[model samples]
Target: MIRTPKKLWVMHRIGNKLQKINNIIKVIPEWRQRYIVNNVEGVNSKDLAQKWASYTRDSSLFIKEDDIVGIEDESRLLEESLMDGELQQTLISVVGMGGSGKTTLVAKMYNNETVKSHFDCYAWITISQTYIRDELFRSLIKEFHQSRKEQQPPELSGKDYVELVNILRSYLDLKEYLVVLDDVWDTNLWEVIKVALPDNHLGSRIMLTTRKEDVGSFSSGVISYIFHIKPLKGSEAWHLFCKKAFSSYPDKSCPRELELLASELVGKCKGLPLAVVALGGLMSSKKSITEWRSVYDNLNWQLNNNQMLEVVKSILLLSFNDLPYPLKHCFLYCCLFPEDYIIRRKRLIRLWMAEGFIQRVNRITPAEVAESYLMELIFGACFKLY
Candidate 1:
């Protein structure tokens, strides 16, 4: 089992990090002593408890034909923006925190028959916070090529910046294409890519989803439309929570004994669909009232001390904290790399085994257990794969 040069380099970096962690543990008294204390007060948390007994999470979380709950109004607004003027290209931007349904909303429209019929071609590209310029262009071109399935598409291989731009602009000259640059983090990248798009004034649409409001402003100068997605309302949040928690037991309602606890749990989610879904998933597995009570009691600790922090980080932290104790170490092991770095499943499991984070089971290799742990984190939305 010879390792590639890249893997060797990664192993080297992991080794260095392990050394650093050793030094850190030496200075700290113990893991239990190192804790996050919430001393900041004044959040006057509203009881926000609804008298509702049933929860309603969406049956279809996919971005297929069916419309989802909580953002029906925003969908209409987005449709209006897309159809406002005739023969004019439009710049549409959607900004929201992570797990706030930005991606899901875009997915719904990206494949919708109406949207597809409106444009000559469609390109959906997920531009992570860290992106490669040429790779972006290649992907856009590839998707465009895919949409039409042309007899002889332009050769995109080995093209330079100016050449690629000319190729793209030429293809889009007389055509109306709906291009979605999802999760764009930098305006500079937009500027570089913008040159490749021919205004054509033919009703071409460029939509982007991002976590940064500045990104929306930067991408959408004048005459551009921006939709800022807020968290779900309390009722909507509860519905989503119920959907997740009671998906298997539709007739079941939060017992009278647990209604107060359930309402408080929903309130703590603060209307984020992903957080609600994650909690519901966590609870769905438990068969006892005490288990639900345990989550209800620990929601504050799981969410950390400050509720005033960034909503996306808070939601992500909640998901991470919900991972089983053994999975916790495996999930955190991923943080050794920089943010927005692409981590593959195989490499991550190998590293976990190296760090002894993977649990050994009877007749099962550590890698098998580690892979299962990784899947849990991914399904829980705490960990994302490349």
Candidate 2:
């Protein structure tokens, strides 16, 4: 059984300190598994070994070049957008659906050569769904000290904690830097923390990433500039799949039949990189054209079974279905078209008009209303077209 660090530590404390000694003794006979053994010496509890393992996992989370792919344009855009701006506390946000590469884009920015060379200081923190301002501050402090290889002093609490955060912000204020608040979901957190930041205007930028538009809009105040990242285009998606599935992009000697079928499936991916990779990997083991067709035929069914599929089509369907009533109706209507269809903006608006889904709002024409609904649906992950 895999034990959590907390459970093992609790067992060591409330039960027997000698139990760890017994564990060490039990591990000796299995010397082939010596690496798995925990050597608890000065530390009296099983928790020490668990803590060490946890630290090892945390250290390995750093991004490596081979692990990153297909985000060069995003990196340049973020770097230039930040450097071009002169305003204090410039907020640059990355917005996209989950698994659409927002976090990956931010990671590329955080680890890029120019970014590293340009900024005097940098901080990266992941704000999960349940974000707390103080927790975020502490995480930033830890990241700051960790990057500089400086020792963190004893933890502060209450008012001392607030003062400590101010100190960290002041230190950041002294140098030009990039601060990335990743996977942010709360607007309230921005409200509370934006006041604490020193307006060091030397091209310092704060980059945020979220799956929600309102969160980005509220934080950045320029919804137009919010980079709404999407999936890989057909060629990019095909290339990505070929690399992962065949260990190279179109490895030697693919049958014409197999190539055609693969192209068809790639179109259904709707430029979503993760879906392309997942479907490609799913068929990687089967060399037979028959097997490939069988899998391709059931792509829609596979989407619903998370256990058997890693594709996010089902989740995207959920987001699509959650749109406002008129938008929901309009989006579903587009599904009638063949996959990879290049939908003309004018034609789609006219169709919506015929269906009576669009009505005049303010002085905006019915066509504008239809177009706005389509845009909203697209941003919501409910619609995808070339």
Candidate 3:
């Protein structure tokens, strides 16, 4: 039987989508394998530790001040909060979606000499989602001691959890300390760890950087402020993009001929600092308009498949992977819509129910469940409801 042209076109589109799905399935396992290998038990090589440290280190150490754009107001406000807050130990958090410069802004303040001088001692601990309790205590102990240029205790490794907690409490009891808990994922971890930090009422602070908005208030019993970081503005994004993309050029300015292409590429980043910087760095070495045009044409493919952009991909994947199983399905279903498509709320919910991505709870309807899922995505910065 002869097939109609429309039917043949439909079959081609389905085939293409299936191929894309297959590629995504293949990449997921590779990502998991890499995580396991890197974080596996007993992988304690010094070189490996240093490599991971570099990855987790505050970007302020390596990133030039000139390259940091659009955060001057945020930096000043965060500094004021850190410096002039109540005497009681307060939990101040900088919350934002991943890659929105939460860590960078906090780190800049954490490293500031003026900020450091206000506190008696300071410690900066990077917390992972699956943090080992004893390991975290050890890092805290080391940072506290090292910040003062003093040697960490010789028995640090041998100490049990209780002993480590006691040591931290004793050390920080009388001192006004500024502790930065970076990249926090678990509220329970904060609940448990905060017990070791004494409230000396000497204007101490526990500053946190988290992607989750609720983690800050949940962890705080005293005054808590959650500073939400936003993506760069249009001009700021352009300035940052130029800084990275044209680092070798005088004034870091785009050439007149490539202005339109550069703006298009930067616009694709949607003012997300990490994406802008990553794409800028990726384009820095390519000198010709042809190369720039090639990159612009395949930008989406590069975001997903390019190794150079892995940091941006990994960050976004963290938010996606943190979603519940059903929510993940709902989120991916939404992605089937074309980019910049303004999906109507009720229609999207109905589509979710039809797709069987929403499950009914005992009291809640499937529509309610779908709405909650959409809100979760919005809160998680996976979706921007306009």
User: Which structure among the candidates has the greatest TM-score?
Assistant: 1
Writing each residue's lDDT as its tens digit, candidate 2 over 1-386 gives 99999999998796676787788688666752432323322333444433222221111123234433566687778778766756565787788765666766677667777777777777787665665567667666666666667775455445355686676777677777677887777877677666556676676678888878887888633212578887777667777667655653346234576898888877867776545544554555568898787767666565656564334554343333345688766765654543223357777777677668886699888777888887665434343232
Off by over 4 Å in 1: 1-67, 150-157, 219-222, 305-379, 382-386
Candidate 1 Cα RMSD (Å): 13.2
lDDT of 1 by residue, 1-386 (tens): 98999999999999999999999879655532333212222212131111000001111134223225688888888887776666677788889876678877776777678878888988887676567687678778888988898643456667878777777888889998889887788877667788888778878888988878888888533358889999888887777777666657746466566677778877877677666766766776666779777766666664566655444344455555666788877755554453334456776676677667877799988878887887676556564332
- The best candidate in terms of lDDT: 3
The global C-alpha lDDT for each of the candidates, from Candidate 1 onward, is: 0.68, 0.62, 0.73
**Candidate 3 — which residues are off by over 4 angstroms?**
1-61, 302-311, 314-386
Residue pairs of candidate 1 with colliding backbone atoms: 56-239, 57-239, 57-243
lDDT of 3 by residue, 1-386 (tens): 99999999999999999999999888866755543323223233444423332332233233545667888888888888887858988888888766678877877788789899898889887775657788788888888898899988887889999999999999998999989888888877668888799888999998898888778667647778788888889999999889888989999999999999999888877777766766676677679999887767666565667666444554344445556899878766654442323467877777677668887699998888888987765534455332
Name the 10 consecutive residues with the lowest summed lDDT in model 1.
48-57
Clashes found in each candidate (C-alpha, N, C closer than 3 A): 3, 0, 0
Could you tell me which 10 consecutive residues in candidate 3 have the lowest summed lDDT? Answer: 52-61
Task: List TM-score per model, in order.
Answer: 0.66, 0.59, 0.65
Error of 1 at 343 (Å): 11
Q: What is the lDDT of residue 169 in candidate 3?
A: 93
Model 2 residue 19 CA deviation in Å: 12
RMSD values for the candidates in order, in angstroms, are: 13.2, 21.2, 18.3
